[model samples]
Target: MSFGAHRPMSVLTWLATPVLFTASVLGLIGLGGMLLDADWRVALSSALFGPAAAVTVLLAGFVEWRTVRCRWCLGLGYPAVVFVAGLLLGDVTLSSPVALALGIPALTVLGVLMRRERNRVIPIA
Candidate 1:
C-alpha cells in the first residue's frame, strides 16, 4: 500500500526524460527573455509557452513519482527556483541555451541512475 509501489515506469518513460527536460528548459529560456525587457508582447508570447513546459516537467516528475519513489520533480524544481530568483533579481537575460543543453544530459543521467539504484522502479515486465 505504499506510494509508487503498485506500478513502475517503462523504459520508454525513462528515455523520455531528456526530451521533456529539454523542452522545459527551452520554455524557461523563452520565459526569462520575455520577463527581462518588460515587453508585454514578448512576455505574453513567452507566457503562453509556460504551461507546456510545466506540463513536460510535471510528466517527468510523475514518472519518477509513481515509479522511483524519489522526488524527481525536485530535479525540475531547482531550475524553477533559480529562474524565479533571476527574474526577481532582474537578471532575465541570464538565460542560456548551453545551460539548457546541459539539462538534457543531466536528466538522462538521472534516469539511468534511478534505474540502476532500484530495479523495482523500472518495470521490465
Candidate 2:
C-alpha cells in the first residue's frame, strides 16, 4: 500500500476540492455582504485572501482526508455541505461575524461525522 502511486492524484484531487470550496464560501459571504451595503470588491477581497478563507480550506481538507477516504466523494460532497451552509447563511448580516465564522468549522465537522457514520453503516467491502 504505497501512497506513491496515489500521491500525485491525491494531491491534485485534494487541492481542487478546497479551492472550489474556498471560492464558494467566499462568493456566498461576499454576496451576503454586498446585500448588506458592503462594497462587492471589499467583500470579495475580504474573503478571497484572508486567514478565514485559509482556515476554512485547511479544515475542510483535513476533514476530507480523515473521513471521506475516496477523493472523488470528498471532492463532490464537501463542497455540497459548504454550498448548503452558504445558502442557509445567505441572509446573515456582516455585523454578525460570529455566525459566519462558526459555520466553516461546524459544517466541516458535520461532514466528517456524517461520512464516518456512513462508512460504518455500509462498509465498502
Candidate 3:
C-alpha cells in the first residue's frame, strides 16, 4: 500500500503547488500595484489577474487541507472561512463583526460534532 517514502500524493499533485505559486506571483504583484494606484496598466493587470491569484490561493488551501487528519475539521475549515468571507465581501463594513459572530459559534458546533462523530461504530449486519 506504500508508494514511496515522503510521497503520499501523485507526482502531479506535488508539482501543482509550486506551479500555481509561481504563476500567481505575477497576479499578486499586479494587485499590489493597483492598490498603490500606480497606473492604468496596473489596474488592468489587477483586474485580469486577481481571480487567478484568488484561485491559486484556494487551490493551495485545498491541497493543504487534504493532508491533515480529521473527521471533517481539517479539510473544511479554511474553505468554510473563505466562503464566508466571500459571502460578506460586498458589505465590508459589517463583514468583520459578522464573520466573528457567525464563525465562532459555527466552528464551536462543528468541533463538538466532529468529536461526537469520530468514534462511531457501524454494525456489520
Candidate 4:
C-alpha cells in the first residue's frame, strides 16, 4: 500500500485503481455531456480526464508495477472493473455489457502476455 519515498511514484500502489477509476468515471461524464451538448465545461473535463484514465492506468501498470494473482484480472480485469464503475457513475452512453462482451478475452490475453514479457525481461526475485 505504501510506496516508500525513495521510489518516487506519483501514486501509491493502492491509490492507482481508485484514481484511475475516478478518472474513468469523470471522463465518461465529460464525454457524455459534451456529446449531449449539456455543457461547455464538459469539453474541458473530457480533454483533461479522458487521457488521465489511460495515463494513470499505464503509469500504474508499468512504472508502479504490482502483481495480482489472476493474470486475466491483471491485464483486462482491473480496467474492466474501473471502467464499469465509470459507466455506472458517469451514465455514459456506451453500453457496458456490449463493450465488455467483446473486449474481455482480447484484453485478458494482452494482459497475460504483458506479464509474461515482464517476467522474461525482469525475472522474479
Candidate 5:
C-alpha cells in the first residue's frame, strides 16, 4: 500500500503486534520446553519482555515497511529465519521448535491484519 493510502495506526494496535508476537513465541517455547523438560520459564520470560523481543518487533516492522515490502516476512519469514537461525545456533531442538513452526503462521496472519488496517483510509465523516 502506498503512503498516501496509509492511515495512522492506533497506539494499541501498534503495541499489540509485538505483544501478541512475543506472547505466541513465549507460549510455544514454554509449551515445547515443558514437553522437552527444558527450563521453559527462563526461556519464555527472558525472551518475552527482553530487549531482544523489542528489537525484533521494531526491526521486523521496519524491514517490512522498507526492505521486504511485505508482511509475510515479518509474520512468516521472520519466524522461519529465526527458526533456522535458532537451529544453527543450537537454540531450537526437535522437541521444542515452537518459534519457527507455530509462530510463523500466527504472526503472518497478524501481519496481514496489521497491513490491511494500516493501509486503509477511513472516509472522514
Candidate 6:
C-alpha cells in the first residue's frame, strides 16, 4: 500500500501502460481525421500521441512479463499492444522535439530506478 514498499521501477512500468494506451487510441482517432481530410495538423496530432502511447504500453508489458503478475500484466498489456500496433500502422507520425525532451528524462528515471532495484536484489557476496 505504501510507495516505498513497492519497487519503483515495477510501479512505474505498470503505470506507463494505461498512459500509453490512452495516447495510442487518441492518436489513432487523430490519424483517422487526417486521412479523411488530408490535413497535416490531424496527422501531426496522431503521430505525436500514438508513439507516446506505444512506448508506455511497451514498458508496461515488459515489466509485467518480467515480473509475472497476470492481473497487472493484463491490465496494462492489451491496451499497450493495441496502441503500439496503431502507431505503427495507423496514419500517424511518431517524432517530435517535445517527445524527445520528455523521453530522455523519463528513461533516465526508469534506468535509475531499475539500477537501484537491481542492487537491492543482488547479494553482496
Prediction-by-prediction clash tally: 0, 0, 0, 0, 0, 2
Higher TM-score: candidate 5 or 6? Answer: 5
Q: How many clashes in candidate 6?
A: 2
Local accuracy by lDDT, each model:
0.46, 0.46, 0.39, 0.44, 0.52, 0.50
Q: Which candidate model has the greater TM-score, 1 or 6?
A: 6
TM for candidate 1 is 0.29
Stretches > 4 Å off in candidate 3: 1-95
Cα lDDT tens digits, model 2, 2-106, are: 542221123443444444445446545654664686543323333333443344445443332544465446545555555555455445444324335644564
Please give, for residues 46-99, the per-residue lDDT of candidate 1 as tens digits.
Answer: 333344345445555435353343445454664365345334534223334443
Clashing pairs in 1: none
Residue 26 deviation, candidate 2, in Å? 1.8
Tens-digit lDDT string for candidate 6 (44-113): 3435545555565555533524445764766466555655655665564443333334445555555665
Superposed Cα RMSD, model 5: 10.5
| Best-fitting candidate, scored by lDDT | 5
Question: Order of all candidates by lDDT, from best down to worst?
Answer: 5, 6, 1, 2, 4, 3
Candidate 2, residue 70: CA error in Å? 16
TM-score of each: 0.29, 0.29, 0.28, 0.31, 0.37, 0.35
Q: 18-76, model 4: which lDDT tens digit per residue?
A: 45344344455555554576633322233333454455455454443344543335445
Q: For candidate 2, what is the lDDT? A: 0.46
Q: For residues 12-84, what per-residue lDDT tens digits would candidate 5 score against the true structure?
A: 4544555466545655665666668774332433334454345455544433243344555454555454444
- Root-mean-square deviation (CA) per prediction: 9.6, 10.9, 14.0, 13.4, 10.5, 10.4
RMSD after Cα superposition, model 3 = 14.0
lDDT of 3 by residue, 1-125 (tens): 54533212222342333324323343444445455655433122333234433543444432423434641553344334444444444333222333234434444554554454444354455
Q: Residue 72, candidate 3: how far off, in angstroms?
A: 20
Question: Cα deviation in Å at residue 107, candidate 4?
Answer: 30
- What are the runs in model 6 whose C-alpha is more than 4 Å off? 1-76, 79-85, 94-96, 121-125
Candidate 4's C-alpha runs over 4 A off are 1-52, 63-72, 91-125
